[model samples]
Target chain A: MSLADLTIAEAGKQLRSGQATSVDLLEAVIERASFTEAQLHCYLTIDHEGARKAAESADRELAAGTDRGPLHGIPLALKDNFCTRGMTTTCSSQILAGYVPPYDATVVSRLRSGGAVIVGKTNLDEFAMGSSTENSAFGPTRNPWDPERVPGGSSGGSAAAVAVGSALGGFGSDTGGSIRQPASLCGVVGFKPTYGLVSRYGLVAFASSLDQIGPLARNVGDALTLFEAVAGHDPLDSTSYPGPVPEMRSDLEAGPKGIRVGVVTELSGEGYEPAVSTAMAEMLNRLAADGAELVEVSLPTFELALSCYYLIAPAEASANLARFDGVRYGLRVDGETVEEMMARTRAEGFGPEVIRRILLGTYSLSAGYYDAFYGQANRLRTKLIREIAEVHERVDVLVSPTSPTVAFELGAKTQDPLAMYLSDVCTIPADLAGTPAISVPVGLDHQGLPIGLQVMAPALGEAVMFRMARAVEERAGFTARPAMAGLPT
Target chain B: MPIEIDIAHVARLARLALTPDELDRYRSQLAVILDHAARVQAVDTTGLAPTAHPLGLSNVFRPDEVRPPLDVDEVLSQAPSARDGYFEVPPALEGA
Candidate 1:
């Protein structure tokens, strides 16, 4: 196989056995990325010089008996929202067009320490606001499977890059299925670790409480490898769990035999695409045939998750984003007074979706409306959490389709924000409960787009999630590559 | 349905300067979204406590010790208007 097509584990084996140098692997990926950039628009910035330098240093270290484990010299991509020292972290918004961070985010620092060579920062919805990357200030990232369709987002670029073999694995933050939904659309493995399992320090806040940094990779094993490297406590983020990080890669080969899996009854049928439902049904059957017991489970509050998320995420976002008022940093426009300047700058800087959310949030949190909107949403959230916890008592993990549909055509749902929000219907509950869930490609839709089977586990239940995900990966045998994968280097 | 005037009020509260056309557009769109979001109210959360955070964490205090901060020059470098390591902004007073 070409160097660009190697998974993290495969590339690591090659690097260790003296079969391929890091420089060679890096060059192959750079070539492929350059060739595919015109069609995919997957990245905001490609750090060619920085990656080449890092790869050379990695080669020197490997030859001199200094190794940085599996990630050493592995070419990876980061979602642009992660702060990279001296690199522009625009979050795909014009407001921070030329803004560069003086320090690296904790996840970026951790990846670098593991010797992972970051090739570029991938694009996302402006401030991670939308399910479809169409909300990106830059043009929407095209699905590699079909150029006319969107790569599901706000982590669309990261998922597209990994699917097209531009990067072995990439990092993306999941606020509400941004990572997993895109991963599902792009036929890749996207895992959102438990909320506190991965530190959120330096991730540009989009609903701080719901945001989490996770991995997008070609397979479950590669996803686990990347997850382990970044999942641990960081004192910088007070919400980070102080407990020991679980060894996700230790028991990958173990099958999901005798494991109790709950098929969330509410998530299936009606509103889900017919093809996606079929793929999900086949996956459940396969799991049942493989010695796994499937029990039908229902979280009555599941239907209310999307409604609650819109209120809570936007409310937090409005408060968190108040920091970008053009005084301390980012785009600034002159006005007669400070308030006018702040308003004018924000007017010119933010996109429609962002502004819409801000307005919605401001209204919801306003004095009189708070008790009805934001307050009620929080109460519903509590009920949802309790319902999910009750369901977990009966099943080890909950399963559903990651997204309700496959990659939808660009501009299909952009006109209707509510329709766009429906794309995350199946995946938002996990974020609401702050649980670990993974999306693994199980089959293809009639349109040839990928369908993802979502495996959700309770907080800190990544081990079970991984085992179930691995089993799905093995059974599905979904080796179909995107048509864009054939682009010549 | 949200009144058009209410949309402008919310925009002002958000510190966003929206054009009249945008105000009209958002007034209708936001009403749709708010109507959809209103579905949560029917769930009967009367006795349930609100969960601002899923983790139930509160008062996450850290040691009050001095730590190295970002360089002033580096921080100012990103500002659109910087003067003597300070962010320059519009005058607070109308004519000052």
Candidate 2:
């Protein structure tokens, strides 16, 4: 088998057995990237020389008995939003024209320490504001399943890179459904850990309260390994969870024999495409057949999750993004005065969708509208969190389709912003309540596009979440690879 | 009450100088979004505290200790325009 086909665990075994070197894994992914990148556009930058040097060092170290565990010498991609020292970190927006950080984000530091090879930075929606990566200033990342369809965003590029086999896994930040939605559409596994479980120090802030970084991988185990590498407390991030990171590797192989899988009643029927619903039903049946007890549970306030998210996230974004004026780093447009320069720079730097969201945030937080808009949304968030917690008291985890439909054609919903936002319905509840959730490929729809089943767990409930996800992964037997992967296997 | 979205005013508050066409386009689009968002207004969340974050945790503080800061030259090098170790900008006091 080609080196690119190996999962992280399998690759680690190869490295340990002296059968394959780190350079061999890096070379395979680099070669795969050369063939697929032109068609996929998954990376903003691919550091050919830097990655080679890192892989060589990892190989040398391993020879000297300095193995850094599973991630050592493993090739991976990062979402552009994460700051990397001396590397361009644009968040895929023009506003950050040619800006490179002098310091690495805490997570980037973790990955580098873990001995992972950084292949390149992946693309996302400008400031991660849009569901479709079409909002990226550079351009949209095409779905590897079909070049015509969007690879779901704002982490589309990372998901597409993993789906196309150019990278074994890629790390992307999940705010709302950014990581999970794209993973679903691209036929891969995406996990969004419980908020605060991962530090946010170097992730470009977009709605600070909601953003959490996680991994997109070819399978559930690889995703968990990637998550384990970066999940921990950091003094740099004030919100980083102080509790010990829950141990999950031991429980991954366990079956969900008596796990109460909550089938979210509100997430069922209506709005979902018939094909998607059919795939979801089949996945549920497979889980039931595998010994998981499925129970019907309702989160009534889930209907308001989208609206609440729109208000709360953008309000925080307007405040967080205000730092990108003309005076600081990034794009600058001179004017007669500093105030004029700041206004003109922002107008030119931010895109239409970004500008719209910023304005919405401003209007919502403006005097007289605060109580009616931002205040009301924040309260709704509290209610949503409470409902999710209450339901989890009975069920170990919640199950739903990752997205309402499979990958849709690019430009399908870009015109109507609301239509684009509606795509994240199934994934938003977990984000609102700050719980752990994952999207695992279950089966494919009639169009042959992959369908994802999302499993959500209460805060810090990694053990149960991984158990159910592994159960789904084993039961689904979803072996259909994207024809566009086009790898020489 | 349906909001009369003043796109221009909101843009000014947001420090974005939108063109007239963008202003017109966003006015209608944002109205539709806000109209949908009005659902939250109908429900009275009496006494429910706003969730600043889902973890029910407040802000954290680092130890108040003196430490070396980033290099001044390196920080200044990234500014749009800097002069003699100071960031250069247009007139800040407007008329002055």
Candidate 3:
């Protein structure tokens, strides 16, 4: 098999045994990325020389027996939002087109310390505000499954890179299903840890309360590995929880024996595409056959998740994004006065969806509307969390379809913003409640698009979530490679 | 709509200059969003307090100990316009 096709685990094994070198793997990945770049548009920037040097050093260290754990010498991609010292971290927006970070995000530092070779920075929705990568300032990332379909976003580029074997695995941040939704659409594994479990020190904030950094990989094990490498408390992030990071890998082999899986009644049926519902039903049956006790659980307020998320996230985004006023960094537009300069800079810099969200956020948080919009949304958020907590009391994990539908054609939902927002219906509640959730490819729809089965667990319940994901992944036996796998280099 | 002017007001608050076309588009879009978000009102939160954060964390202060800060050059290097060690911007006043 080609070195580019190996999972992080497989690549790490080869590198450790001296059967292959990091340089060889890095070259293969870079070459594959180059060949796919024209069609897939996965990366915002690929650091060829830096990656090569890092891989060479990794090989030298391995030769000297200075191993850096499972990630040592493994090639990967980072979603462009993370601050990588001296590397352009655009978040796929024109405002920061030429901006490079001065410091590495805590996750980037951790990944580097683990000796992972970051080959490139992947694309995303501009400031991670949109559902499809079509909103990206650069361009949309095409799904490897079909060139015409979108690889979901704002982490579309990261998920597409992993799906197409451009990278062994990649890192993407999830605010409202950015990682999981794209991973689902791209037919890969994506994990979104509980909000405070991962540090947000350098992740360009979309929604501070909802944003989290997670992993996307070809398999559950590889996703878990990437998650372990980056998940932990960072003193730099004040919101980071002080709890000890759980040993998730150790529990991978544990089956769903006697595990109670709560199948959320509200998440299934109606609104979901017929094929998606069928795939979900089959996956749930497989879980039941594997000794998992399936019980119908209800979170009545689930319908309010999307509305609550749209309000809270945009409000937080408006506040967080106010820093890019053209005074300190990024694009600047000349005006007669400072206020005019700020206005023109923002008008010229931000995209329409970003502007829409900022306007919505500002309106929601404005004086008279605060009690009606922002305050009401927060209260609904509390109710949703409470309802989810009550459900968890009876179940170990909640199961649902990762997305209401599989990957859609490009421009399918872009014209209608609310329709685009609905794509995240099943995935948003977990973010609202600060729970760990994962999307695993279960099967393909009738149209040959991949379907993702979502597994969610309460805060710090990654172990249970992983166990359930592994069970479903094993039973689904989904091994269909993207059609792009056959593309000639 | 009752809050059509709020779109322009919000844009100003956000320091974004929207064209007339954008203003019209956002005015309608924000109205729809607000209409949809109005569903939260049906929940009747009553005495329930709002949740600013799901994890319930508060007052996450770090030590006051001093640590190395970013280099001035590196920090200023990202600015579109910079002079000496400071970021350059338009004048604060029209003719100061």
Candidate 4:
């Protein structure tokens, strides 16, 4: 009934049919953000002036007989790591507290060109280094389901904004499940496309090999729409897929009938919470009822992913983040010499988690330990890839709980790094393999928090992945909204 | 068991200046994380080439034609200190 409740496709139809104006949609977004921002902390900044101007221009364009597709005039958010010409792009880190990019990232430019109204930028963990948003230099973004709990990270703000209706849909960079884990915790749809499927030209690098820009939206169909607008090769990013992006169709009413789904044996019931496991078991039963052929598939390499990721990601981060020295841009501290000033600036600018990662990375790449840590992780990565590829030969798509548990309290696992890392155990395997995966809200936990089912497909297999995700979305019939939406402002 | 290593030495190599208090905290934290990640060594990677990248792309080359570059003035303006459209930093090869 509410303006924010309408999916992007529905809202686009209304805009084209003269039922709702772009201004009306913009107002709905602002009102929702104002009501919930204090409790949810979903955004790092809200560009009211820019968004209002963009909405007005979109209205003018449509009235003048030019249409820009589903996102035309619809309010959408981008996670802060993406460069947005003049908008401040802080990766929830103090090092670049007020830094603004001089040029737009490839994705940002594409969305702008598509006539989407840019609402604002969302927060992320400091350089996307943590599983919990608690690692952000700014305070953690709270879950919309319950304000005391984390929304998940490093794309937590994007997930929270979408869940709470602060934005219709948003784009987030997923490196090690930054997008999906948050989407799972916040009860929304998040898709991490296969590696090389999207350009990362202006995304602040975390792990260059693993980072990907994708969509977080209300449901599977909406996620596919957003992904289509941004996916494809970009000449600016040499790592982008050199071939034409595969055609993706949006007619996704297909059920999981006759599809062979692999239930990852390593991730099923053992480490997941009872509430989460119950929902997962129920999800499998529903899939089976919908004519999906469910079979147990083992990906033993799953156990090595978490460990391998920590080393490989941090090691790459140490190098990618070295560009933030005091010389070129961002925070600078005074010292007697260049190196001292650089060191002091970094020491003062970076948060504890960032420092911990840099040290770990440096130590791994150090002369005495290169063969022991970073090198070993790379070799193991190859082995992991091969083993995962072997399993994918049998199943059309693999399924698992997106996260091991529901949204936990803000400080629940922050003190213990290992405990915090375990939250991402289910999601990291797909990231390591550079394959496509999506998280769909399957059902709710006993505490009434949302649970997500992850659908994974082989490299460049997004068509099948989206089909299965849509099937799960339809069968689960998860229509419950977070109680935060009903609370008084 | 936590393995032995010097946190201070690693910090210095990374060009990070950490206080004694921070070093003590990191020493314990890094030890635990490293010990956990050590499991990577147990993975049987025999006969497999190291995977530095998932896509396995090498030396991606673009056309030699010149393209528009970022504005120097705009980039320098965002730096902490700039002089005559150049980023200003302390003299290198001196200080720690």
Candidate 5:
């Protein structure tokens, strides 16, 4: 089998057994990354020399009888938002287009310490603000399933890179549905752990409260492996989890034999394409056939999740993004006066969607509207969390369609922002309630596009979610490769 | 309610400016945005407390401590404009 066909987990075993050297694996990945980047537009920067050096060091360590476990010699990619020392970490925005961090994000530090080879930095929506990669200042990432369709956003490039076998796995950030949505569109496994399970320091905050860094991999096992390496507490991130996470890999293999799966009634569908709904149903049937009990649960507050998210996320974003004023780090446009410079700089720096959110957020926090908008959204959020918690008491996992439909054509809904926002409705509630959720590719739509099945569990219950996801992934048997054949046009 | 969006006011607040035509465009677009957002006004939130965070995590803070400073030259490398040990920018106030 080709090196590209091996998941990170499988490749690690082979590398440790002397079946393949790190140099061999890195060469394959580097070639794939270069080939796929042109057609797929997946990466913002390819760390060819860095990856080679890391791979060489790993080989030396292996030769010296030192092993760094499952991640040793495994090649991977990172979403552009994560900081990498001495590497340009543009969050796909012109504002920080040329800025390189002097330090690494905690996740990057952990992954490197775990011996994972960093292949490249993937493209993303400008500051991770959009559902489609189309909002990227660089350009939209085409869906590996169908070139005309979008590979879902913010983490679209990361998902696309993994789907095309350019990297064994990629790091993606989830705010709303960034990771899951793209995983669904691109036919891969995406996992968002419970909030605080992953560190957010140096992640280039979009909406600090909702953003989470997670993994997009070829399978559930790969996702589990990467998650185990990255999820932990860091003193640098105030939101990092202080408690220890469950042994994810061991639990994922145990399956859902005794687990009770809940199908969220509200998240199922009205606007969801029939193919995706069918795929979700097929997974539920498979789970039932596997001796898992399926129960229908109600989260009545789900209908309000998107509404609550828009208000809360933007409100936080308005505050978080304020640090980008010309006085601090970021692009600055010069004007005759300081105030004029600040105005001109931000005007040129931020995109329309970002500006709209900032304005809405600022207004929502204003005296009159604070109680009306942000206040009400917070109340709705509490109700939603309570409902999710109540449902989790009866079920080990909750299932839904990751998104309403398959990838849409590029620029298809740019004129209708509401239509684009609705794509995240099913996935956003998990973020709102701080739950662990995953999107695993299940089947293909009528047009041969990929569809994703979502599984969610209560906070810190990622193992349960992954267990269900593994079952669906094994049964659904999705093997759609990127249309570009691992090379850019 | 503010019948029309004050483009200059919003632009100043957002650190942006709009031309007359762009102002007209944003006025119309922002109205639709507000119209859609107005749906939040109808939900009844009486007796419910506003949740600042979903995690129920409170007082999540780090101890304030001094750390080693960045190499001044490295820190200043990307600065658009800088003076000795400080970043230089125009100003925050309108007429400062």
Candidate 6:
């Protein structure tokens, strides 16, 4: 069995039938994680001993006839941003390097409850601020398909882990396309649910309103399974929704026969590489062939999304991260006095990109500039929300390129921060609108790298996104493992 | 539509004591960044209220309830130095 072909759902089936023991399955996953870690630099830490103990317990549970449903005995990875009690949830930053949380993030608790064994915590950009994992203190995570290129980030490590079969599925947090961009570059399916669908209680705050925890997996089915496990209201996070959670897997069975799929006109051309454009167009053709109506919808304000995002996200981050001052927790820097200590601590703890964000955010939210910058950005955000709402009335799902192109070589655009930020252009609109979007592997480019097709559903419509994404995955049907393919031993 | 990106000012704000070479490099980069940012000014947003959230969920209030914190000593053990019940650090002010 090419374990790569087995989604988490299929893996669960095998585990339930006594076809594979959790320890045996986890050993395979751990080995893959280690192998990929060495080449792709995907992990900041690997917890084999803990994972083995968890796996052993899972076996005990199965022996006791107490299965935790589809996720029982499944191996999963978590982005470093999600706090896993007793594990260093560093967010790949020196600021929180030695910090280990005393309690699990709501998502971590949910995943554990569902019987998923966490193999390790993956690397990411510091504080989930940058589009490239290059900002990570540990080091950049390489794209699994080509070691020379980046895995789209800040969820790069999570995406790379899933892409290389290091884990059956994993969790990632998205702020301005962090999850979807990496998923696209790594050629896996990544979903970012509606903002409030998944509790953000333990997710290390980035842009508070923008950050959301979601799933990255081999296929849409696995994505749905993982999503269902981690999503729902949490008493700890008031932003979490108490509304209806869709039966995503069943919705997939109902399929895309009459769904209205819109091709977002603004996301189509200018910055997109030919391969990305071709991949998206091909998916549109496939959806049309499956009897789904495809229409061209306009998001006129989308051109301003990146601008508004930069201002608003940073403005909020500046406030949220203020609690990290030396007094509270995490890293502390000593100085002659408390004021100096605070200054020294912040100066020494944060990376250049993080400091840049805090300053920019502080400036934007400053009293005199508030109306000119933050206030104006919020207004533009409202218009964006209204436009997206109107468009959804005409379409069941929206289609776009997840990224402008395949992963670029390391250091290629790092020096040009502006160019680097543009990599997220295609994926940012959905984040601004608080919609659910997923990136599914569509095809490969000439050099044999994977491309992704982004499918977006309106607020709380993750099921529709999954149905459409699965349709594209089914039709395009491209399955090439990362260059360093991890076939079972 | 030209905005001067002063590297010295930026360096001071970031608390980085930049060398001459570092200042020049950052100056060139910031110039390009601001030029790109100027695109926002050209946008006609006369009547639009700036958006703070795309999802429209506002007034997200959690129940005010006290929860157990991590072991204080264990959490504080992570600090570089500590004394008594407070974190021990260099004093707040220094006569420079």
Candidate number with the higher lDDT (1 or 2):
1
DockQ of each: 0.77, 0.81, 0.81, 0.80, 0.56, 0.44
- Tens digits of per-residue lDDT for model 3, A1-489: 678889888898888877899999998888788778889999999998889889999999999989999999989999999999988999888889989899999999999999999999999999998778999888888999998999998899999999888899999999999999999999999999998899999999999989999999999999998988888888899899888987676777788878999999999887899888888888788778878899999899998899999889999999999998998889999899889999999999999999999988988898887878778888888888889889888999999999998999999999899999999998999999999999999988877889999999998888989988998888889898786744653
TM-score of chain A of 1: 0.98
- lDDT scores for all predictions? 0.90, 0.89, 0.90, 0.88, 0.84, 0.81
Locate the minimum summed-lDDT window of 10 residues in model 3 chain A.
A480-489
Residue range A1-489, candidate 6, lDDT tens digits: 545346887788788888887887788777676566777877888887888888999999998999998888888889999988888888888778878887899999988888889988998999998777989988899888888899989999999989888788888999899999999889899999998889999899988878899999988888888888988888788777767786676678665689998888998787788988987787778777879998999998888888878878878888887767667567777766676567667777888777767766765676576776777777777888888999998999988889988888998987777788899998888888889999988989998888888888888887788888888888878677776754343
Instruction: Tell me candidate 1's interface RMSD.
Output: 1.3
Instruction: Compose the digit string of candidate 2's lDDT tens values, residues A268-317.
Output: 78889888888778878877787778999988899888888888888889
CAPRI docking class of candidate 5: medium
Per-residue lDDT of candidate 5, residues A258-338 (tens digit): 789988889876898888888888778877888889999988888878877888888888888877767656798898787
Span of 10 residues, lowest total lDDT, candidate 2 chain A: A480-489
Question: Between candidates 3 and 4, which one is better according to DockQ?
Answer: 3
Candidate 1, residues A8-77: lDDT per residue as tens digits?
9999999989999999899988888888888899999999899999999999999999999889999999
Per-residue lDDT of A351-402 in model 4, one digit per residue for the tens?
Answer: 9889888988888888888878888888888887887788777888999999
True-contact fraction per candidate equals 0.85, 0.77, 0.84, 0.83, 0.50, 0.45
DockQ of 1: 0.77
Q: Model 4 TM-score?
A: 0.98
A-chain TM-score of every model: 0.98, 0.98, 0.99, 0.98, 0.97, 0.97
Backbone Cα, N, C clashes tallied per candidate = 0, 0, 0, 0, 8, 16
lDDT of 1 by residue, B1-96 (tens): 442338878888899998999998988887888888878877788799998567787677677889999999999888888897788888888778
Model 3 ranges off by over 4 Å: B1-5
